[model samples]
Target chain A: MDDFKFPYFFNYPPYFTLQPVRDTREKQIQLWKELILKYCKHHKVFLINLEEEFPLFSNTSIDRRLTYESREVFLGALVSEGRAEWMDKGHKKCLILWRRIQDWADLILEFVHEYGLEEGVTTLEEIRTGDETQGTELAGIDRVVLVKALKLLEQRGKAAIFKGTSADDEGVKFSI
Target chain B: MRRRPGISGLQTAAATRDQYRSLGENVAKIRTDLMMEQLSIFRSQLEEFARKHKNDIRKSPAFRAQFHSMCAKIGVDPLASNKGFWAELLGIGDFYYELGVQIVNVCLSTRPHNGGLIDLEELRGLLSKQRRSSRDPITDDDCLRAISKLKALGSGFEVFSVGNRKLVRSVPTELNKDHNQILEIAQARGYVTSEEVQVSLMWHSGRVIDTLETLMKEGLAMVDDGHPDGIRRFWFPCVGSTSGAVEAGSELSS
Candidate 1:
């Protein structure tokens, strides 16, 4: 296995503990905050196991890992800002509210709207890996994210994306 | 912990009964003197702001009303927690004005942040430019005198009154040296992050008067020609103190 290394800020003591200084904490929050979103997005991580030792949660070379309380606080900050969501009442499984359900759904509608695919239907797998969605926000988009976004447009009576031939062949049919 | 000075040479409160009795007189004297000078400065600053931003001034009735309400409630116009709110409510202009004035209300005193003579000059400059001016009806001297009557109002006013957990005098002069050690013991971060200190002292009218009086007589911390920022701030301006720095965070919740 390759040796692991932490970033420069990973060695900063405040990275592990909660910062109380308003200004310092703010900057710290910005750095951690952006990192959280970026890391999750890159890994296509839909869920963050809060109780388990996630690699992103720690930097062993620097001997620094976020405390459970700090983890909760950072994640809580995300949840508050609508960037992430709690999957359960216990908050053990955070269905990373990344990209926002509305926004993800907007992506689908925009694809349909832009491509003029209003009456056409496309499979969910097709959306997850279609040439049309390539390099767009929709490419490699989480299945849950796709469903939620489509559901949002559905509520608006704009389109419908749902189950197709059996359980695996789900698709969308845009009413518009 | 004890606010009263406890130097060895200084007579103990009990031992110096007569001196202690005079202590009340001394506090009253200091308090009175500080108020007069502070008020003169306050009125002049207001006049200057009114003069300089005449058009924006006229347009910002809602923002002004919000400021007035905050000032009335706690002698400080409370700043909105978010900059977006300020932009939406007060317009994108005058962020410095919002921050400056609110800092006065919070850290400084009820006294306006400028001197009367300076304000008169600012007002004069505006008038020279041929602009309509506020008939505020009170000269700096008149306002100063009127506020001198409020010399007692600033009494018992304390920074600890501002709610940080409503922890009375919970603010320490310095961050705990152990903060670094605690961080080391706790998490993964190890880089040093410096804090940003913002400072603006607003003197109460009563305090202004007292400053003026004191400057006339004993000559207290009078470095910046009647501007309390110079004296109270010990020269560095606008959040320079190593102690007063607060941590920075994201500009947006998003």
Candidate 2:
């Protein structure tokens, strides 16, 4: 696994604990939110499970682990900003939309136009793991998020999806 | 014979009055002159004493504070000007002025992070860092005096106490009675829960939460939910010694 380069303050133990000072805590939360988004975007991390240990939530170099409450609060802040969503009612897992669905849809449309995939029939798996997506941000994309983006495009009449012979295989036909 | 005697007696009485008046005026003149001479002597002696202990007075905060009180008793204002016998000889005024400038620097530099409100001890620690090489030590009293001088800038610098700690506020936010009362209650234990605030302040829960929320909004207070009692404790950093609390927090986490 590639090591994510944490910011200088990441090593500071106090950063893991939620500050009690109102102004200090707000700044701390804002920094945490930014770092989380940047890290998720870089690593293409789609979900963060609070019940399970998340690497970003702890810094082994400093031996600081964020308390569960702090984790929930920080994630709660992201959810409120619409940048993230709770996957379950318990908020045990969070879907990190580092790039919002709307933005992702636009990226997909750009990819389609760039690659001349506009009138081409391609499997959903190919779009995610095909040579065309190789080295692109769409490579290794989460199927759930990819489906949601494709559905958005399908709603706009820019694309269509049909099930392939295998239940796990699906194909998309882009009209644009 | 009676008239002649009465006339002589009146003349004698007038002479006696004149003699006594002259005598009284002479005594008053000598006493005034003597007092003036003694004051000059006392002034020079004080100057000599200040000159001899200049380093002690400057290096030791307790000594400096004592010197200030002594000067106060004698109706002397050593900090009256940056240039004078006291300023030139002892330079105490310049010391405080330099401290005031450094305080402004620290407060301004940390203002973004602290929202223009800093704990007094924290400010002192930073100030000491700036003057680490200097022989003079900065104390809470020194910081208070320096901040008091910063008030001349009209930049809204002021020192106020909350609980047992002092906080320097560079903003003009007025803390009302409710805010002050809440801070006062938090001083006893470094924190106050909503129930504690309600019971001690004789206020409704709504009022207690409302004021605490306002304080939290202003970044003057912080909430802690680590307690097992399920009661959220609102901590006032400005009211409690931050170093002590930081140590306690680290200990708990460790």
Candidate 3:
């Protein structure tokens, strides 16, 4: 992973702790949410497991770390905003949708149009790892997120997903 | 001989008028001189009294407040200028000016954490720490006066009350009426519930929530979800001392 540059406030110790003041905490939470999205987008980080140490959630320079409860609260806020999702019933892992699903679906369509892939058949794996997607944001995209974005397009009848002979492989046929 | 008598009578009358005019002028001059002497005496006595109580004025908050009131009555403002006799004799002007600078420094340094708002007592504690070498005791009133001088800097420095506690705001953020009312309601226990605001302020739940949400967005309030009753409690850090809030938190947990 490349070095993730933090915003100036990332070094502030209090930013790591949950503020008890409603107004201050709200501002703190807003800043936290923005920083998290920016960091995730920059590093292509899709999942934040609360049980594990996330570099953005802890500032070693100030020796301050967000408590588990604060982590949940911040992630919960993101979930409510539709910018993230709980990966399981335990709510320990978060799927950060820095780009909303709708936007992701649009991006996929744009990519298809840009590459003249309309009415073309491609495996889900190829869409994410294919040489054609090498320099695009679709490269290295999380499989779960890609599937969800594809399903959204499928719901609209713009694309179709079919299970391949192996469970690990899936193919998407874009009709648009 | 008759003509000479008439001229003498006229001369006597003129002399009498001149004498009365001189007498009146003499009385007025005497009164003016006496008043000047009395005023000089009073000013000198004030200077002597100030000299005797210089330490008291600096060390005791009560004495300093009294001194300020006396100065007000006499129209003598020691803080009016940082030069001349008052500044030289008392150094009060420079004292507050120095304090104002230190306040700005503390506010700037803590802005990233508190968002330009700090509890007045906390500020005093920090200021006293900064001025520990001087051994000059400071008080809330002193801080108030010092902060007042800082208003001239146009830095939006002002002292405001949240509940009973005072907070110093270094930034120009406006706290609307709804925010102040919520803060005032939270003063008793350092925290307030939305239900409490609704009941006490007679505000609808939506209004209460809207106001509280705004306060939270501004970083002036904290939400506590640990209550067993499950009612979210909003805590105001600016409404009370940190230690006091900690104690209150412990009490709630217990």
Candidate 4:
């Protein structure tokens, strides 16, 4: 990562502090909103714990970390823009929807189609950890996000999740 | 012992300059070449005459009497008697050219400029007057209305001062510098002309200001720099000694 020297503005002090001035805040919010989404999409990061140190929230060299309030401000801005969401009321866990939740569900449907899994039944565990998804972006998917995408498909009556034994050992049947 | 808010026309001046220049060029183009040459010659001759009398006009008792009499008719203070050397070089040849003015106001005030308090009643009354025009017919009213709101809410605000008295903080103060905030927003939203102001207004009242500020900060709506053909480029918000960078630096340290 050091090889990719960040832009000069990365060193700008205010760039780390969440701006409160409306005009400045709008700009800072925009840059962060874009940067956060870009970073999450690249790393395939789903949950962002505001309590923990995320690389996007901390600049080690700068000795700066976004305060919890700043994180809420940025994430709250995203939620308002429909680009992200809070997983719970505590506001501690966030689901970074770099891509819209709808888009993610669409991607899952497309992936199922590409693998000729249309009308096929597969164990939920197999779909997540099996060799087919090993090298794909779907391999390390968050359980909540996967359930969400499956539920979206189910809403359209395209697929269904059935109980097997436990929560981890579930199965999905698709009707094409 | 007070500093007044910087004049509103930093943005307005940019527009007025372009407008005046374009009008000057158009007038020059429409007149015959011979007429232009003759006018130029007459102008030079007038300058020569003004220069010759510059010294005499200041020191000569006879000339001072006439000068003061002429100034009295126009209600201007008499030119200083000591106006010597440098005044001759500049020459007053353009005196008779007949400049036009859209608005002019003169008044006396007892209010202290740096009181950190703005008399809301005075500001509201001032903005509601016809003088608060944009000089562009379209958004002239909108600009006035915006100013009106700013006035009621407090236009040149400082921390609430000693009870009722308002202070006129230095123009560079962060809190008082927001008069140009609207311009900064407009620039960022890409409203390159007066026309864009109307379209952007469709979103929300705040939208116009947001775009204006963006432009000013990014130096897009800067006068004579971007969109030369457009009139919106005429207004600039950064005119005083303090600049966008200075404000940014102070904020950075904070």
Candidate 5:
């Protein structure tokens, strides 16, 4: 994460503020959207809690931080673009979809094909934290997001999700 | 002088006045014709000079500026017509025209950031960057000439000075003296608080806020309210680090 480089404008003081003019605000929002996505992806962060400290939203050197309104505005822009989603009605927490659900579903399918798991039945937890998924994008995956991706795969009739022997365990069978 | 008492004497006096008037008209016409001939000769010689050193004028900024000055002294606009000898021989007309178009593109591209106002030196840098494929290097003088030519299109393309910096304004919004003063104050640190402006400019808070708001509305200034002091800071990109270069060493090390 130390190798992650922020944009040059990240240090600019005014970048922390929400622009008032239409054109300027539009560009500002665009830059913020890009920075948010890149930052989350770099840190492997899937959630942004607006109430908590987000390092990208502040520059201590310049003594500037994005006000709550500006933070919400920028995150709201991402939500409207389908790059993120608000987790609560108050918009305090946001689920960052750095990679869209469709792409994640595709990656999951690719992973299954790479591991020759097309015909094998595996539990949902195994795909997420199993040894075969180590050092891969699927490691430490968010359950809800993974479920949504799996549901998308199921919709295409490529996979089946069903209960295992115990009520707590869920298994997925990939048809190909 | 004797007074004329009859119609014959009056007629002679009137004829003499008419003769003098005709002589003056003839002299004036001949003088104009001589000037036109001299001007035509100067034009041909200039054309010959341009044709001979066409590469120098195109390649060197200094030589190009000198050539433009000389043309100005003789009252010949080499960039007036795009189809004539000047354009055909030197392509100076097209040069500035191309520069003008590039200027507009640069301004438009940076407008989202700088709000249609840019430092002239930065503009030249961007223009040269955009013109990197061409052999010619443009000067500030060339930019001024091209921008002056752009004034004909009536889109508020003009250069003005604030403090020691020359700023090119592409927007039609006019900046009054107060706005200029605020900009000058902001130039030192890129951001100015209303209290500072009020103290330095000896202006009331109302005037300061009004002017700053105008700048904000015009996208010339952005406001920061996150400072520990809790005072609003107005940041002017046109006068600030918009043209700042990234320190390569620090970046590489980091």
Candidate 6:
């Protein structure tokens, strides 16, 4: 995370401003959208609270900060591109989807095939924090996103999600 | 001769006028033939020079410029057409045609960042970088000539002077004196303040805001509103410190 390098345009002062011109604004928004997704994926950050400080939104060297309206515009563009989603009606929080849900589902299937867990039953908690999932993309996945992906697999008859004896122990039974 | 004065004298006068007319016609034809012979000699000498120094003309921009001037003196346009004897003998027409294509590419690629107006020197720098594989350096003179050729497209590609600096405008944006003055002032720092423009140009706030806003609308200027001094700064990416900033940023990332 500390070794992450921003693009050259990060130092540009105008990048912090919402451009008034049509073509320039479009380019600026596209760059911002890409940088945001990259920064989020590198840090494993699934949530962006627009109310709080995000390092990518400002450059101290140039003394430039994105105004609140500008931040919404950039994030709005990301939402329209299906790369991000607003967490609230007020747009104070956003979910960064560096990897789309379908792609994540495909990764999970690959992981199951690699570990020979075709017909094994494993708890949701165990899948997230277990040694088998260590050092993989699924190790620190957000619970909400993981459940959605598991549901997609369930619809495809690849797995089943059932409640265990206790509510905390939800299990996933893989069919193949 | 005195006895036959009236009729014989009139006939003699008519005969003398006809003889003078024939002599004048002969002299005019001979002069024209000599002029044609001299022009042909000049053409042959030009062909000989071009054949002798074809490499110099192709490799060195200064040498090529000198050769162009020589052609101009003789009322010969080597770049006038791309398929005549000059094109076949010197390939100078294709040389300029290639340069024009590269120039347009650089302008189009950098237009998003520079808002379609770039400093002439900066344009040459970018042009050379793109043409590095060819090993032929481009000069300001060459750029001007190539750009002038672009005027036939009538697409608003032009070069103009502002505060002793030449700027190549790729768009049809009209910039008045106030806009030019602001661009000139921003060339020093890459950013300007309304206060600076007002004090330096001795204009009131209304005029300053109007001009700067027009630039903003055209995408030629970007506004920074987060300074601690609470003053809005308008930055011009087409002028001032662009290369230095790019180098510094690359150093940080690398």
**Per-residue lDDT over A1-176 for candidate 1, one digit per residue giving the tens place of the 0 to 100 score:** 22232233443333555554354455556667777886777667778889888888875543556878777878888888888888789878777865789878777878888888889888888889989889888888877677777888888988776778788888888887
- State the local distance difference test value for candidate 3: 0.81
Model 4 accuracy (lDDT, Cα): 0.53
Q: Candidate 6, clashing residue pairs? A: none
Model 5 alpha-carbon drift over 4 Å, by segment? A1-5, A19-26, A109-120, A125-141, A164-169, B1-37, B132-134, B245-254
Per-residue accuracy of model 1 over B1-254 as CA lDDT, tens digit each: 66756674366655688777799899988998898888768756655654565545334645455444544574533233335433334442343343233222333221111111112222222222322353322222222222222233443222211111111111122213232122222122111111111111233345444433332222111121122222221111111111111111111111
Question: B1-254, model 3: which lDDT tens digit per residue?
Answer: 45666788999999999999999999999999999999999989988998999888877879999999999898887887788677888887888898888989988876655667788988898788778897678888888998988887787998888666788998787998888898888778767999899998899999998898777777666666544465667866565454343344344334
Which docking class does model 1 fall in?
A: incorrect
Expressed as tens digits, the lDDT of each residue in B67-132 for candidate 5 is 888888878888888888888998888888988998999898888878888989889887777678
Can you rank all candidates by TM-score, best first? 6, 5, 2, 3, 4, 1
**Top model by lDDT, which number?**
5
Q: What DockQ, between 0 and 1, does each candidate earn?
A: 0.05, 0.10, 0.07, 0.01, 0.41, 0.47
lDDT of 3 at A4: 55
The 10-residue segment with the lowest total lDDT in model 2 chain A:
A5-14
lDDT of 4 by residue, B61-173 (tens): 46645654654574643222215322344322111110001111201121111112223333334333433453212122222222323333343422223223222222224
Cα lDDT of model 4 by residue, A51-122, tens digit: 898877766554456778888988998989988878999989899887776876787787789878889888
Candidate with the larger lDDT of 3 and 6: 6
lDDT of candidate 6 over B1-254, digit per residue (tens): 45756887988999999999989989988998998998789778888888999989988988999988987887888888888888898888888888888889988987877789899998898888778886688899889888988888897899988787899999999999889999999988889999999999999999999999899888789877677788878889888545556665666656
Q: What is the C-alpha lDDT profile of model 5 across A58-142, one tens digit per residue?
A: 8776677898999999999999999999999999999999999999999899899998988878988997899988999988778
In order, the Cα lDDT scores of the candidates are 0.48, 0.81, 0.81, 0.53, 0.86, 0.85
Candidate 2 residue lDDT tens string, A84-152: 989899989998889988888998988898889889888989989999989888898888889989999
Output DockQ, candidate 4: 0.01
* TM-score for all models, in order of appearance: 0.40, 0.56, 0.53, 0.42, 0.84, 0.86
User: Which parts of model 1 have CA positions greater than 4 angstroms off?
Assistant: A1-8, A19-31, B1-254
Tens-digit lDDT string for candidate 3 (A1-176)? 55555654554334555776665667788888998898899989999999999988876654557779989999999999999999999999999999889988998999999888899988988988999889898899888899999999999999999999898898999998
lDDT of 5: 0.86
